[model samples]
Target: MNSDQEHYIQWQKKEEERWEALCGRCGACCGAFDKDPCVHLSRDELKKYYCTIYENCFGIKKTVNGNDIVCGSIRTILHSHWPGDDCCGYKKALKEKN
Candidate 1:
């Protein structure tokens, strides 16, 4: 690849890392604060939430209560309401920007 392409790719990786860093790692987005959360949800040593199947978390999945739902990117869930909707860092950031 060209120098410009390599530079752009590196820049994109850094940007993605920066963007991911904005998350407080509260796990509210994964339905942790919901009446029923995703079955794959797990907590880190710090109590931060993560998905066990994060690499392929899209599409249909079950909540802890056995209800089925199609999971998508955080972008897809941003405008909708959830149990701990107010706790989302992305939403908080957007609110601050606006």
Candidate 2:
């Protein structure tokens, strides 16, 4: 690949890694904070929490108890409160970066 192409590819890869590394997968943000969480939060065989509809995860969703709520990117609420947020990688990285 040309130098420009390689640079763009590397930048994309780094961005993806940065984004992926930001999530701690603690599931606290998903519903651990609320008594009821959206049904999209599912645990894998290894017990790691994952979004059932990750691609469409950013939007309105409902709690398990049927409460109306809006779901969006974790970054949107990084400075806010949530359960198990203490282990969030994004918060840690931000603190260290500053």
lDDT of 2 by residue, 32-79 (tens): 566787888888888888899998888888889988667877778978
lDDT of 1 at 93: 80
Compose the digit string of candidate 1's lDDT tens values, residues 1-98.
Answer: 99999999999999999888778877787778866888988989988888899899998899989988678888777777877778788889888988
Q: What is the TM-score of each candidate against the true structure?
A: 0.90, 0.85
The lDDT per prediction is: 0.84, 0.83
Pairs that collide, model 1:
none
Stretches of model 1 off by over 4 angstroms after superposition: none
Number of clashes found in candidate 1? 0
Tell how far residue 56 is off in model 2, in angstroms.
Answer: 1.2
**TM-score top scorer:** 1
